[model samples]
Target chain A: MNTSENMKARLVDYIEAFNAADASRVVALFADNASVEDPVGTPLKEGKSEIETFYTYATTVGARLELMAPPRGSHGNSASISFRVHITGQDGRPAHIDVTDVMDFDAAGKILRMRAYWGADDYHVLADAS
Target chain B: MNTSENMKARLVDYIEAFNAADASRVVALFADNASVEDPVGTPLKEGKSEIETFYTYATTVGARLELMAPPRGSHGNSASISFRVHITGQDGRPAHIDVTDVMDFDAAGKILRMRAYWGADDYHVLADAS
Candidate 1:
């Protein structure tokens, strides 16, 4: 498969893992030494343990992110995706988040690192019907 | 100059050209037979004349697009930018638009074609206080 297609498949797995609350599946997608950086200001998550901790918290807290845009980047072992996340917030509310996930890939197409960018102020938490 | 820097300079020129309402500045950046596809459903603008027509009408209507994100695509002679646009709607109102500009470049680093993706429904026309 081409690089872009390979990258997309990995992203789909990651998305499914989040939605399903399968922390192990999500953690398995990342390399053992992989790091996760969401936004420029936030501290980076390095190593499988740290990344595992981050995803475990977000997914367990009921953040179900639904993607809006497809993965878009070009001809590299990397892909940057823009997506809108729908999730149940801690306040028992629904929230929308626009995020850019910059990801790097390994030779076998596994995720090496992912840096996410989204500003907290742009989106607001709204009361959920459920 | 590096590819990203080259692409950014061209985009800045394109932005300034829009703000200054200069048709030639806009046209000069694109290649002679370049195609412009704004959204998947719209027809592509092939060649300089069509491109000129599109820009002339857009800028003439006082649509000034200010970029929010620096060029983010990596390596290749391509860049995808995300921006929040502030414009004066025809009804004499201020409007905010969120747009993504996907641009491709040649080996010389000039933009060859551009595909823009944004939905019209996301924004609404409001009365301008000015």
Candidate 2:
């Protein structure tokens, strides 16, 4: 596959791993030195160890991601995936957070950098998917 | 209208003004001290004067934007619009660039910050729309 296709495939893998709560699989998709900055302006988590810890905590809550759109603008060694993450809120109610993750890849196709874009207001409590 | 609807309307106005090549209208949608970071990692253009200059140059080149999808995840005074920008290349060939612009708004519904996400490789020459 070409660069765009390869990167998109990696994105799919990342999302699937997240939905499956397979933190190891998610961490393995990144390069050892990869960095993740969720919400863009936040402090970044660097290296596989930190990334693993982050995902472990995230998946422990049974968070699941459902793609809202197919990956877009996948070109060069970068692409973005937009989705809604479903998780239980502190009140034991279902909440959905809209998120878009932009990723950059290394020559070997491992994610080198990932930035998720979403704000606090992006989260909402939903009654149902319908 | 609520915040999300207001932001989405502003996003539509921005795109319409861009397609119309109305630099002044585009600049007016932003606050006097607004900043634009096209491609996200580039040097930001601060203030309306600089913003107007940027749009003027962009429109002068006959750039046009077509929405590929309606604005997404518009909430809490922020939204993102994904589109295809049509421009002529230096070689006089037709080119299309895929772009997603994420915007943050002030209480007055003026754009406070705008970040466009796309890379050089996102530009592709097209034989036809099909």
Q: Write the per-residue lDDT of candidate 2 for residues B1-130, one digit (tens) a residue.
A: 3355567778899999999999999999998889998865678999998999999999989999987755654424567777889999877889988787878788777899988767556778876544
- The worst-scoring run of ten residues by lDDT in candidate 2 chain B lies at B69-78
lDDT of 1 by residue, B35-90 (tens): 98765236789999999999898788777776664544434456556655677766
List residue ranges in candidate 1 displaced over 4 A: A127-130, B1-130
TM-score for the first chain of model 1?
A: 0.87
Most accurate candidate by DockQ? 2
For candidate 2, write residues A18-53 as lDDT tens digits: 999999999999999999987656789999999999
In model 2, pairs of residues that clash are none
TM-score of each: 0.53, 0.66
Please give, for residues A1-130, the per-residue lDDT of candidate 1 as tens digits: 4355567778787888888999989999888878887653467899998888988898887777666555543344565556666776667577866665667778767789786655444355865556
Candidate 1 positional error at B46, Å:
27
Listed for each candidate, the true contacts retained, as a fraction, are 0.00, 0.04
TM-score of model 1 (CA atoms): 0.53
- Indicate the docking level reached by candidate 2: incorrect
